[model samples]
Target: MKALTMARLLIRLFGVVALMTLNSVAARAEIAIAVAGPMTGQNIFRGEQIQQGAQLAVADLNAKGGVLGQRVQLLVGDDACDPEQAVAVARKLATDGVVFVAGHVCSHSSIPASKVYEEEGILMISPASTNPKLTDEGGANVFRVCGRDDQQGLVAGNYLADVWADKSIAILHDNSVYGKGLADETRKQLHKRGVKEAMYASYMPGKSDYAELVSGMRAVAIDVMYFGGYGADAGLILREANNQDFEVQLVGGDSLTTEEFWMVAGPAGEGTLMTFGADPRMNPEAAEVVDQFRAQNFEPGGYTLHTYAAVQAWTQAAEIAGSLDLMAVIKALRTHRFHTVLGEISFDQNGDVTAPGYVWYRWTKGEYVPAK
Candidate 1:
């Protein structure tokens, strides 16, 4: 009787073990996706936007049974906007079997990391890396939901020529890939429009005081300054300019879209002009998603919707292709137009967005609005 009882107990234990193993295998069968960015750096705000956007995208997709009928596993990687760290994050995500990635916001991080995704057969869709070389020089696996610096530069340059033509235009860059590229593009457009800037300079970023630079600009009597850099540095420059009692019209690229600009410059940021894509949150098609974001007490601003749209495009392509193969998705993305928060959009041969470009905005009372 004791031997029989022990045999029955052993059978029950084996059955439990087998069921646990099966559950583990089932969990592993889901498709893995990731969102990577500067999650822990000074630029952590950008990462937060991407992370939140990806979270909603994945959640919404999963609610519909995910792509190809496989549930999606979402992973988050913090590259801190560093090139090497971005590559490391890419590799780690690849090893974890992530087939799709929707991040690496900074152009500096996105370009190098694209090489890794290319080698590892992962698809990457950047939401805010605007440096043209990202798509111009990257593998076919790379794509972006945002407009390029060249496109943004053209819009800014034409505005400068048309509106501030007689002002002594001063163009400045921060020596980073995004900054310099945007400055060069703006300068190029100015030249094309027969406008010559009074001062063109490069400055080191992350410096606290730009009083010396401000004094130099004051000496030149720069009327309008176009800074192709992030918000903090632009704010610092403007603040320094204000300190010297030298008020100038400050303009910047899309990087100034965040409130970080205002938080840094305060009242000095008033009347500052910037170039950004038309706000997607105001889109009629995005009403449901925007409402969903607000229900969580979060505002879907800046690149948040762009990131969401990137995931939307990828998932829609994968769904249409009925597979998650990199080439299949790429083909699907290129050949098909995706209706996203950004509206109907498709990619050109260079993997650049074939959509309409950028528009101008002006800061007033700590917020930005469409500029006339």
Candidate 2:
């Protein structure tokens, strides 16, 4: 009887150990990916856009049995569009064991955070970071879904030369990496076309009043202002100009992609022109996802589709590689063309998307459409 009792206890102990091991395996069967951006600050909407896109993409991937049969676990980080904070967020994601990240919306954030991603052996794809240096200075893994500032600026400068050449044009930047880089490129092309700006200057961002700057443009009788800055500041400047009864056409960069630009500028934003990619929201490949967003009462505008494409590309690359190993996935990304809502995309030797470039957008009545 004693021997039988001991045997029964041993059997129960073995069964418990097997159950624990199975649970452990189940816990390890998920892969961690991250979407990071300014989750808080004046530009918190950017982070929300990144998160929404990533969430829906992950959902779709899981419904398709996930990547390599492993459930994808997503992480979120907030950089507040600050370089230092972005670096910190990258480090945290690394510590969290994330294998992939779609993040760092601003060029200011993306450029710095990319170093951490490279060092940690994580792949990063930016949905909207457009400064050339993010690719020119980034590692093998850094990529963007947006066109470079150089390309965007050329189009903008050429348009200005063609249409607004005779007007008194003033150029202003916010003195950040993205703002200044875009301003410089536009100015370079403007100079190439022999059209000199009436004023080239930097305005401090995050200020409530741009009255002084508006007065400067007014003093110069500036008929047009080419602003290389984010939408919030551009709208504020327009409001200040409008308040002062100074009528000046504001041509801004792609940062004005959101409806927030209109909300900030109000009626003052009427007829404002900005540069952005051809709207991916209008693409045929995007129709299903677009309908999904609309069903949820979300427009999925601006960089939302771009972020979705980033995830889609990474997903396809991982599946092609059949392994989440960094080098293997990287090789797959370089070799394969990914069909996304942004259309078919493939990475170049520099990891830049081999894709078509920029176009002009004009704000008419509260909505921005591809300019005619």
Candidate 3:
């Protein structure tokens, strides 16, 4: 009888050890959140911002014991802001079993990557892609945490109409997806406000000389300009306009809200006005995250707040659905209001959040501040 009792106790101890080992394996199993962006090239800073924002989100999630009682992992890919590369990265992320994704920060990158995500039935949330076409593609799986280009354009147009009503304005764009889309929207809104411009011209990106465009504006006596493009073209235009003595108040979208814009445009960017979707410092709930980012010496920009909101939305959806299924999470994300650093967020039918969060900012004293 004693020998039989000893054998039974040993078997029970072995079973317990095996169960603990299985639980350990389950706890370590990774649920990856893929992060894609222009990790190389001229716009690398934008990709860095995306990575920083997502990393910060993952850290915060893990600090709070993570999602579904498992730690979150980030799998990053370099899309380089190229459309084809974006699609490839999306495919790779899908193959890697990445259920939740954040980014492909550029409009050009996000549009194509979104197609891949849609095909794979994977959920993707973009932090910075503002082109209307991204959400207009009719894919329910794709969502944007940032404001659409039309929304941002309206903000810029309203600012011009109210602040520089007496000034003659000209609209310029690089004819790219982001540039042309925003410029056209601004033009429509500006026309509605009866602020007709002196000239509306399309310029090719990376041109060394904008002399003809600048001279045409000079002839028209354009007093204020609304440019729709990235910092490179905007910087060139500012330099060439200055060379031709064409001084005007320049206003643009969130693309101009970067430190690189100021560095490239020099003093010309000093008075430039722009718009951003979310402000991190303004939110009370984001104070701890902001302090944490500053401690790590990371410059969290507009995308940082949006990325945090994306993670929050996903975590909330997971809890609501009680599953890690992508489709269920997407459904929950569309219908449920998720609390974020930017306040409560809920998506409309078009996968764009209906929030009155857009604000106009101007560069003053080396910092971007809203016009009082």
Candidate 4:
């Protein structure tokens, strides 16, 4: 009887140990990834794009058995496009055990957040932070799926100098890192191409009135204007110009790609031109995913597809490396070509995508289409 009781106790103990082991394995089966951006404040649209893209990517990857046989869990961080807030978000993501981050869309936010990611050994892939300093000053762990401001600026400046050279031109900036940096690059390229701007000025962003700036442009008889700012300020400037019966052609950077610009400028936004990567929605490879977004009533415009492609690139790199280890994934990113919705993508040593140069687009009938 005593021997039989001991045998029963040992059997129960083995079953308990097996149950705990299974629970431990189940807990470790999920891999955490993060998407950080300004989920609130003025640039919330961009953050929404980031969130949607990341969420979709996570869902699709999990449905396909995930990466490295582990399910992916996506965590979102709201930096509000503020630098200090971005750092806090980054630290939280690091603490949350995310091995990768796809975010902090604003250059100012990404630059500071990148340092935190570096220290915490988190890999970062920015989908829309274009300021060159993000890569110029960033650690090896940082990468961007978007073109740099310098690249986009060259396209803008040269287009202005070549096509609109006969017209009087003004260059204006909002003085933020992205705005000023892009403005300076465009200015540099214009100067290099022997074009002199009629007016160069800076304006405070987020103001309701830009009538005084319009007055200045009118005074100079500026026929073309290049604005280095987001859609909100750009819309106000255009509306004010239209109110004053000013007919200058408005040109801007990628931030003008959103429908908010049209919402703000109304009919005045009709002729505005901006530079951005060729529309990803028009890509044949993105048809399935684009349809998925449309079915959910989301337009995968602006940086939405870019953010999706960022995750795609990370997944491909991890697969190529055969591991999710930070250094292994970094090595794979540096050396492998990724087949993404953006087409085939490879990274340069600075972690910038090697495909898709910036192209011109013009607003027409409430939408931005490829320029003729």
Task: Put down candidate 2 lDDT per residue, 1-372, tens digits, no spaces.
Answer: 999999999999999999999998986798899999988887877778888999999998888889999999889999999999999999999999999999889899999999999999999999989899998988988888778999989988998899999999999999999999999999999999999998999999989998898998999899999998888898899999999999999998888877778899999999999888889888899999999989988889888888999999999999999999888888998899999999999998787888888888889898898888
In candidate 1, what are the lDDT values of residues 1-372, reduced to their tens digit?
A: 999999999999999999999998887769899999989876777788889999999999999998888889899999988898999999999999899999889899999999999999999999999999999899999999999998999988998999888889999998888899999999999999999999999998889989888998899999999998888888889888888899899988888887778899999999998999998988998999999999999878789999999999999999989889899999999999999998999998888888777988899998888888
lDDT winner = 4
Cand. 4 Cα-lDDT: 0.92
Clashing pairs in 3: none
TM-score per candidate, chains pooled: 0.93, 0.95, 0.89, 0.94
Order the candidate numbers by TM-score, best to worst. Answer: 2, 4, 1, 3
Task: Candidate 1: list runs displaced more than 4 Å.
Answer: 1-24
Of candidates 4 and 2, the better by TM-score: 2
Q: Tens-digit lDDT track for model 4 on 162-246?
A: 9987889999998899999999999999999999999999999889999999999999999999999889889989999989999
Which wins on lDDT, candidate 1 or candidate 3? 1
Better of 2 and 3 by TM-score: 2
- When summed lDDT is taken over every stretch of 10 residues in candidate 1, the lowest stretch is 40-49
Model 3 lDDT, residue 80, Cα: 83
**How good is model 4 by TM-score?**
0.94
Off by over 4 Å in 2: 1-20
What is residue 85's positional error in candidate 1, in angstroms? 1.2
For residue 338, give model 3's deviation from the true position in Å: 1.5
